[model samples]
Target chain A: MLEIATPFVKKAGEAYLLVLQRSSEFETYTPAVNSARELLVKMDPQAVPYEKGQLGIEYHRVDWMGLSL
Target chain B: MKIILGILLVLGVSCSSTNQKVESTATTDETEIQAPAEPLKKRKTKKQKSAVVTPPQEESEPLAEEKREDPYLGVKEAIKNANWQGLEGEAQKILEQNNQNIIALNALGMAHFYQGRPLAAKYFLNKALSINPNSSDVKNNLAYVTKKEGRSRQAIILWRQVATAGGSSSKIAYENLINEFTIAKDYKKVVGAADSLGSQNVTSVATLNSLALAAIVKSEFDEAEKLLNQALEKENNNEALLINMAILQLDFKKNLDQGRRYLDRISFLGVQSNRRDIVTRLEAVAQSLTNQGEVK
Candidate 1:
């Protein structure tokens, strides 16, 4: 598994670096991903539980009344 | 394991020292000649078998040397260009050669993420974390993947940990979390997040906008007004704040004249003018008031 995971760890490290080097540029993809309101609506019946087991994500519920989607 | 380590040691030595290849050739020749010559064909068979095996082992040495000099800088350039297929392919090849390398896995996962394949990205990223859970980079990437998959809460948690990890990257991760929550209209969380950010590279416009929105959600109109006014003082005649302020004034202030003035400013925003809807409602309200006046 360590053999399988080593390359991914290194690439992830590069991505972390890229986030810093390219901080000023606006990303159209990331914000859409971070949209909690949209995520919540999508989560109702369609969302699958994350494969790695959610470490503690159940607590961040969407305030449904506040949802604009 | 020990045998593998020994092979690697021999391989390293053979690859580095120029004299080693000549020494191995001479030793192979001596061994072949010293073997008992039962039949010419039998002797030839033994020598030919050894010769075939030796070249492959020797050839691998140069390949390993080239791999050792791999340009890690090029990996990033590939990512910037959105050539994730090429990047992932190279990382996969490195893994095929040395399955225990962390760099390859990280790069492959990042490549998958950039390629907009969140499910695959999560797989590699999760595998990387399990190998070394303490890796801040892996954590950040996993969080990013989760966010891309529309798992904001999970992403937020990871970003929080990353931000506190004491690095330039972590600071950026924290700001990204802030921006995400702001766009989601999660103002309550934004207020706390703003305080926790303490001092970082946060922009005043983004921060004040978040705080103003948060205050409005909490029904602290006075606080929201103060924040909006402060923001306007800095960026005079800001459209978003002006529109939001007008919405608040119309809904809560009973000041039609000031509300209209603010709404009129929104008309200049063109496509962003959410005011048309509000204007229609306000007109209805005014019509109702006029009818009531006639009845009186």
Candidate 2:
């Protein structure tokens, strides 16, 4: 099911950036979140990493149409 | 254009089948674009008499020629050329003549959908659905809109209906369900849906394999084994199934030799290099399990 991907947000210095998963579920959210956790902890010192499973992201699948008249 | 036609031709054949037997569509982790695969002429719409525009009496001789040439040729060509705006204009023109034209309604819904307007897309799709409740095309498209609107649970219910109803686009709907569940990491719901689809024989090898993986994640080893065996019966050469079986045998079944047998069957030749690093990693894990011998 290479239909869609998971999403995550990361902190780049003072600003936070959102990374939306446009394709492929294989890329996953854990790695991205893990990196973000590292950056967050540097700033807060008490920030925690996301545990394996449910990343709290919701996704919408792509639908295609043609002149299906 | 050739590729779209060739794909449409193939999907046209698959759509005609009750099982929605698209062997390639059921493939696990191929990372290839799928579904949109069912777009274009795969829609088996009935010709509406009122959709035809009438010609004046003096020009009636060429009416047959005009009809044969297709009044909706612009709409069809716009769709073929991937011109959503053109399709939107043509569909609006058709609807201006006959408000009951399902094709125009569908095209309008699709055009709006492509243009990133889910609300508008829902409007036309619902209109089409109101005209015919049984249309898998409209229902499936509506399901996409509902999902896009962030109503995934509702979308699942709709997809389940389309999948079990057994139609041309049932396979695509079913695959969409698998995709949603996988992304959500909702393995429990996936197993539930797979069981329901399995009872109807509408589920595919990839889905069963996915269900098996889900079962494994849930620590439902027995259910995982059952699903893996079911999938293996259909496609013995499938790497996903074999790898899953190997994991089950070695880690859970405590049968390293059986695991090795399943691993031996995998060649990695069929694995897509662009996105199948997981499969490659699994190969290493299987090798490590075999090398380590029996372990608790």
lDDT string for model 2 (B1-296, tens) is 99999999999887778354555455632433453465444322212223365344337667878878776888888777879899899999999999988778888898898888878988998998899888887788788887777776678778878888986667667667765765554454555655555424534666666666666666777887887788779877766567567667666665757766765676443644532554455556667776666453
Put down candidate 1 lDDT per residue, B38-108, tens digits, no spaces: 78877766676778565755788899988777645445556556678887887787788876566677788
Worst 10 residues of 2 chain B by lDDT: B42-51
Task: Assess every candidate by TM-score.
Answer: 0.43, 0.43
Please, what is the whole-model Cα lDDT of each candidate in the order they appear? 0.59, 0.63
| Best candidate, DockQ | 2
Candidate 2 reaches a DockQ of 0.06
For model 1, the superposed segments whose C-alpha errors exceed 4 Å read A1-69, B1-70, B89-104, B163-169, B203-266, B272-296
Candidate 1: fraction of native contacts reproduced: 0.01
True contacts kept of each: 0.01, 0.09
Candidate 2 is graded, for docking, as incorrect
lDDT of 2 at B105: 89
lDDT of 1 by residue, A2-69 (tens): 89997875565455444423432322235533343233334331331111010111112111111112
